[model samples]
Target: MAENAANLTATLQVKPSIFEIIAQKSLNDILQPAFRKLAEVLATNFPKRFAWLNNYCEESFVVINWLLQYNYLKNYDSTFSENFYGFKRMCVDGKSLSNHHIELSLLFIVLVPYFKRKFDKKVTLYMIEEADGYFKQASILGTNLRRKM
Candidate 1:
């Protein structure tokens, strides 16, 4: 009985994974409003480029929410850094991401794998099709020639 209790306590105290933490927080806090705002901003700022997001209907919300959580692992002299913006960590309280700051290529790169794993087949296909244009635009406009691919 004592062994059972100890094991139960340990199991209860198990820490959530980083992915869990981000997913829970993002779903609760930023999903709806961010989705609406992203649609409005994308339509207003880069209408021709990001216009497909508006046409995605309900799925656009999920796709935008996923894209906003862009992160990449970077290694610097053996130290690893995770560049993430999902928690609004870099923003003033209550502010969402601005359209001007959206990095299309990063969204394309990060969201492909994320959608594939998290969403159903139909949604994933739609998201990939939409993001392809962003990827190509990023390739042409982005200053870094190495990232052109």
Candidate 2:
């Protein structure tokens, strides 16, 4: 009976199915309340940027979900889990700062965890250049503004 059971178990392929892949891909993280509130502020203050904010939120959610799935599948922790929490905080701080470049920095910082998370699972970030480009780091303020404003 033990031999039969082992054979049966072995014969049954336990690999993930297409449905499982779809389900995993559909997973979404619960957005933190603070993050939601910040999004609300962004929507109110910069309605034009609201679409960007929503896109960012969705991307972040997908990243967190993917990381959680990878961690479960591999039976291990990932840097994404460690970085997600910190990334949110950094983004908020960057957004609060008056510097435009820092605001961009904050945006990219928020995206880093997502990029790493997706990359680990062999998924693309879609906008590769936007995700890993030095253009984001360029200073927005001019020399004259540095002295006056």
Candidate 3:
């Protein structure tokens, strides 16, 4: 009986079915309440710092997202990663800041963690849904955010 069972098992090939994951998310969807609370915290605690940020009507977080979404962002990303993981400097163009650039920097510094958090959640969800999928996407984001940053 044991031998028969073993023979039957051998006769039947067994493997988990591979599933293709296709997820859709809109560009607008990701921006929900983005870095807004962080900006508020900065305003409340360190009121003097970036005081103009609150007054400035233009959504600075939008610019940071824009930078992350920038087609030329690779120009900055490689420098950031090289500086972070391997070596020498944050050799970023924004380092050569004009007064206006300082505002953009402030926006970036505050919003980066928020963006990282958002991405981390997606990465986990992606890993859960597909350990390594051929078509993992943040969908309509128009960029492979994980691949980029």
Candidate 4:
């Protein structure tokens, strides 16, 4: 009975995982208004490139929240690809991630992938156009050659 009590205490004191931290709706509630404003900023500053975010902000956030809830995804380093973000659990011992860091991480992890995974042709076209334009500019400068597929 004492061992059971000790185990329960240990479990209770265990640190929350990054997923658990991100899943806290309190942080979401505090930061989402700012995030919505960020959405506006993206739409305003890069109207041609990111204007589609305005149409899908709420839905995109819903998807992000859903992804942050899964335990299995917490440890996944590749394939799903959270490694692109700043905060890894191993590096964060005895420290806390700033709200800004977490917010950007969520944006990269979800928003970037959301565009492609939806398989929306329009999104694909936009990316292709941007890539082509960028590569063309680079080729003109002799920095790199654009290979034709």
Q: Best TM-score goes to which candidate?
A: 4
For all predicted structures, in order, the TM-scores are 0.26, 0.24, 0.29, 0.32
lDDT of 3 by residue, 1-149 (tens): 79769878744644322321111122223343545666766777888996656554235765665565332233433222222332222335645334454445434643665567668989999887784453455454455646544
Candidate 3 root-mean-square deviation in Å = 22.7
Candidate of highest lDDT: 4
lDDT of 2 by residue, 1-149 (tens): 79768878754664646764445433322333345567768877888968567557646554554444344323322123323322112234544323454434434534665666558655454466655553445444322323454
Give the higher-TM-score candidate: 3 or 4: 4
The lDDT of each candidate is 0.52, 0.47, 0.48, 0.57
Off by over 4 Å in 3: 1-32, 71-149
Better of 1 and 4 by lDDT: 4
Candidate 4 error regions (>4 Å): 1-25, 71-149
Which is superior by TM-score, 1 or 2? 1
Q: lDDT tens string, model 4, 1-149?
A: 79768868755654656775565534434444565677889999999987887777766565655466232234442212233332233325545444454555556555655555556768888999999999888888889564678
Candidate 1 vs. true structure, TM-score: 0.26
Give me the runs in candidate 2 sitting further than 4 Å from their true place. 2-12, 28-38, 41-149
lDDT of 1 at 76: 15
